[model samples]
Target: MAQNGSAPVWWKDAVIYQIYPRSFADSNGDGIGDLPGIISHMPYLERLGVDALWISPCFQSPQGDAGYDISDYRKIDPLFGTVADYEALIKEAHDHGLRIIADMVPNHTSDQHVWFKEALASEPGSAARERYLFRDGKGKDGCEPPNNWQSVFGGIAWTQEPERKDGKPRQWYLHLFDSCQPDLNWDNPEVRTEFESVLRFWLDRGVDGFRIDVAHGLIKEKGLPPYTERATMVGEDDDKTPSNAPMWDRDGVHEIYRAWHKLLASYPGDRMLVAEAWVKPLSRLARYVRPDEMQQTFNFDYLLCRWNAAKYREIITDSLEAMHEVGAITAWVMSNHDTVRHASRLGLKDAGARPQGIDAAHEQPDEALGLRRARAVIFMTLGLPGSATLYQGEELGLPDHTKLDRKYRQDPAFFRTDGKEIGRDGCRIPLPWKADGPSLGFNETGELWLPQPEQYKNYAVAVEEKDPDSPLALYRSLLAHRKAFSLGLGALEWAPERKDVVEFCNGPVRVILNCGDKEVTLPEGEILVASHAIEKPGFLPANAAVWMTEKAE
Candidate 1:
């Protein structure tokens, strides 16, 4: 893509498909999916057509937070296979003309990571001890954690040490995510050096690039303030409450990233950096993507929109407008592992019907057509001005599927226990890969780590792949269309999608959708992509989406 060689090894214009290793597909029937499993599916990706695959974290970890909590940066977890497996996977992907960008979580590491464990064993002044953030507190004297910071998963963000050394009381370290995920002390040059080496480790292994997680949480203020919030008002009080003070997107994080980018600059291809900046304000968000640090930061305004056409239109337009001036590349996302699936969020049908085949005929508002409609939206979004992120199973239009009752959800949000909200696990369930196989194409060991719909097996890639009209097929077509036009640019123009449709244009191409409840007339022109069955040049169903590039007329 960057010719023979270029530097940010730019994936900015790339359409990245996320692969949650544990749930993607099982090659060994070991219940858990592994690198080999992902390798096996690379051809499928090439066929479906994508420039690159952004596999989710596969590094060594306890997996309490799936692969997000890394126990070892240089090694792949045995559960997901070994370093050799990863090398093979990457090499094979490249062989197939696809790029592979691994997920890198630099802000924190699992408490079980060797560095953190060593830090716990050493005395305060020891080299190992200086590698992490630690501050003495009254927790050893039966007092609560220092400066109440809430964990993103719930409860206090800092965890108190059970074991103490010398006469000092027990100390605590901050974790913006789960307690097991201890935040790294970026103030320490050793921490920066260590993470820098981690990047080189993969770069040496020939990785295309990295999608840095919680990219802005590398630093924290020297002394965080105590938590305080009014309890009188209720409903997700956690949002207003400070189980602990916020520890993300803090001060001094830019220098840390700039330093990392500097280290990455020496590599062969232009290494790419995409930051996940969840903090508010487009101004603050802009810092992560300045040419010095990351190439792009996640576009925040576009995803939170409600399903209404006008609302969606504004978010899209505003995002493009705001970022248009910034020197950084743009990125767009409709769904990710952390949020509700787009189909469900858009109020489309999941696996709600009985096992019979889905009907293309008129149906309830939540049926499969919603997925088809979603695919069309994805095509337009990915084909727009910046880079795009694809959550695993989004290509299949997979909906949320989780069975852990209220009490067992691993999400800290549930532990925060805000009026029975179904944490994010629903969006992280195993994928269905076969038409009638047990455990879908996912895990086989005990019932999968999360629940699977009965229609799960039927939704597998192996099955739907045969049907030319399947959601997977539409995704492939979109990807192919993208590959043909992504590198070069065309101006984007807003077009009519209908009362229910969401429409737009990129140069000479036009995209139309019938995201509403009735069939619509297609604009007269050359058609590029239609989410639903197209009997003629103009007729389209209620949920159909169409893409086109008209001839001179």
Candidate 2:
């Protein structure tokens, strides 16, 4: 059990592993992963020692934005499986003493959704049209978009409806992401009531909670004002978001969450909600987790922090302080489906840089250095006083498929940006479960939606499971230690300042990370586990981290 020792609050100190359903496994021998594939791997997840699983969206989608463009909230996509498959997955996960957190997308729905279809067919100012953001074009002829807001993918945010048979002027609809994903107008009471029921639909089916997609974007600023600033992808900005940005992190978003929180509280099993808010300024982000709102939010600041010890220290301190103020636990993340794998990202020439995608022409990441740093960081993250979200394949030390060809790219961001941005396909490639196979054991038929890199063979779980020093082994050990010590629920204390190193104590365990090139002398304690082997006694290698307990008197 996790530190909280209560069914309702397990998330507060749990290590939740994120499973990108499309690429995790394919039990049906199809190229794409399905719910059955996930059920087949329950034992693997159970052995991983994570307290819960945060499965990415598998709801009926048009595959636009890779499942973010949800079409039907109540139905599971056939590509993944049917409703029975999802129910079985939930049951199997709970059977293994694990909790399941579904990805709920309330901000927008696919243009193919029934609501959007009805809205498109209905006349302007009708209730159907009111469900979404539809407005007359600004110019007299109504050919121009209502506002200059740009989509997060690319181009203008508004898309004009097709010409009508009656020859009436076309109206434009707002989509912060791709054109296929029309943003819902939360101002409509009907929208609120419908989404609340959507939450209940999943909660009733036995899901432990939800990881709310674009949690900060549900409510746009009133009047839908034009945003003149350059548009950037989500989770890219490090500084504070402008108060008048027009769409993101608006104060009204809290009301929606407060009601959802109440709905969740009414249910049994301590059902919870986690926000994927990419909002800035630690204090502002804290508001999402205030007493009556979400229980947790992803700590993107920690994920974006550079490799420098000082930067890591600052991010950790600020994150802990901010969450403490709200009486909520912090959730630390190193990588996810949306970002480049840390094993590759940390090894880049610029450790702080977050490229949209990597191709053959891109400068190659330093694999050895990146894997070394990744191991060290994971050790540090596990020892911290909060929940840790481990992305799939990170335990196998997987890196981005940097050489993925453009022809195979399916991310909407790629097409929307006209190939200027490579998109996230490289990171979403299927996981390698075995060392020798046509598709690295992702499926029986060897078919793959995205090609796997040649190097993936070396990182396969089958190969890692037999190697004691592998990242997989290290993760199991770290998780075991974390649970035994209740580290996630313990307090963090900074060790004496040291040059080019981050040292901290969580309960009886002390963690030391060496960011400098030179070796550091070991402290007086019994070594528990180290990211790298210590060639010489009493010395820690550069870019390595170790956990230790106090020596007996």
Candidate 3:
């Protein structure tokens, strides 16, 4: 963003708000969020001070793994709305100065997708079957899966392809996620052509950008080697070092993006792509945003850091330095559809590594403590020298609904793990718009796809709108300051004389975060914002952050 010679791209300083469409807002009382619902909320987002909106997948899907298992790349899911409805949302969003970035899930398609269906109908060696990874099972009757790789959702990655019309033994097809979501073979030219067409279809409709889901997982190693190491939900295997895992972050992935970059360049309006790659070490993550690849990649390293000041500074420095090498801006994220809400996670004494889901309804978090830390972290995330994303409900300081009844959970991981993991249902609960309603104003009907926790009423937009110190208020204030101070566009340098604290300056603004247990003396300046009330005017308490401007010389 600080680079010269050409005008900076809008995304460099943009504050992107991620909306999980299933829970954002529902129109037509269908108990599901739709494009019309997002359109109605554009003014709300504009008021919130975000520059762009990245809507989670709304493509035609079978509702397995939510909308990630897209059935038709060109059509809007009937549950969300019609194509006309999506076009209207894009037009309205742009009119309000809010760019729309649609989610593109190119890693795989729903088993119900036309190609996959045809693959099932055809024999193992057919051209349709070649679009996906199909291999003969390695056993006497060829019943064993091709490999021992594990699925992200807690089962073996390979699923037996349905029997052919002749009723011979079936072959196995690779599915890195749920069985309903079959991995597409990037080696196939047809697969690449189809996705390029999908990109153009939305770009032609005025969409400004795309948030690529599983961007690093799109390509696999040619041999499909056995996966002997355990994998974290998102990143490289347990050791924090890159491994030769046949399914993730393969070198072949870069070629796919290089081609995609060319396609995006062909379109006007500076259309862009942000990769949701979870590869480790800032160096590997930086590969996603190389000059010929995506414009930005999500900084999961920062998101996964424990609540320690040293780690915070370390990751920030590492991330920025990595992006600097690639001449790309880093993107920061707090929470999203797939993870636990950071608000509640911050409350845990140990916090541990990010668990994909809570194990029990009884593992309640301390709401007050979590909200304080969450509030402080926002200043740190937004003040950094790059783009930032706000997950829906995070601005409301919404904690994960840990008490959701097991019967109501829909995330496939829950069922796959057989109750050992609760899945992402906690963070995916429908948002509370108004203070009171049968479904807390998420829909006109009393029903919702995922039930809202009763406690959400207190954190509803209406209530926060009236509270000066609410998370919503803090977010709006910080976003306003972020733009006014040119924080995201500025260079970052660590400030001196801060002990047990992460202190930095972004251009004219000095940001200080106290992650230690003791109070830290605040540097003298005009106070811009503080995460918590200053018990002593010149001192900041533990688990807080402050933004200040140096006084005139």
Q: Give the root-mean-square deviation of each candidate in angstroms.
A: 5.5, 1.8, 1.9
**Candidate number with the higher TM-score (2 or 3):** 2
Query: In angstroms, what RMSD does candidate 2 have relative to the true structure?
Result: 1.8
Lowest lDDT 10-residue stretch of candidate 3:
235-244
- Candidate 1, residues 1-553: lDDT per residue as tens digits? 2454543344657777778888787777767778888888787878877667888998998987888889989989888899999999989998998888889998789999999888888776678767777766654473467766666665666677766657556677777677888887777888877888888899899887788887766666666656453211112211232222345567588887787677767776667777876655566677777767877677745655545567667766766666665665568877777776777555534321111111123232453544655765775576576778788888888765533354445665555546234567767777886765467656454446666766556557887788887778778877777767652144568875457667777766676766566777777787777766687656777766777777657
Best by TM-score: 2
In candidate 1, stretches whose alpha carbon ends up further than 4 angstroms from where it belongs are: 1-10, 125-127, 138-142, 165-168, 227-246, 348-369, 402-421, 443-447, 496-501, 514-522, 534-541, 551-553
Report the C-alpha displacement of residue 202, candidate 2, in angstroms.
0.8
C-alpha RMSD between model 1 and the true structure:
5.5
Error of 3 at 34 (Å): 1.1
The local lDDT score (0 to 100) that residue 523 gets in candidate 3 is 82
lDDT of each: 0.69, 0.90, 0.86
Please list the residue runs of candidate 3 whose C-alpha ends up more than 4 Å from where it truly belongs after superposition. 1-6, 235-242, 359-362
Model 2 regions more than 4 Å off: 1-8, 233-237, 240-243
The true-structure Cα RMSD of candidate 3 reads 1.9
Count of clashing residue pairs in every prediction: 17, 0, 0
Residues 1-553, candidate 2: write the lDDT tens digits: 1225444378879999999999999988879999999999999999999999999999999897889999999999999999889999999999999999999998899999999999989899999999999999988889999989988888899999988768898999999899999999998999999999988898889999999988888888889877796445453446534545778889999999999999999987778889998887889899999989998999988888878899889899999999999998999999999888889988998885678888888988999999999999888899999888999999999999998989999998889989988889988999999999899999989999999999999999999999999999999999999999999989999988888899999999999999888999999999999999989999999999999999989
Give the candidates in order of lDDT, highest first.
2, 3, 1
Model 3, residue 21: displacement in angstroms?
0.7
User: Candidate 3 overall Cα lDDT vs. reference?
Assistant: 0.86
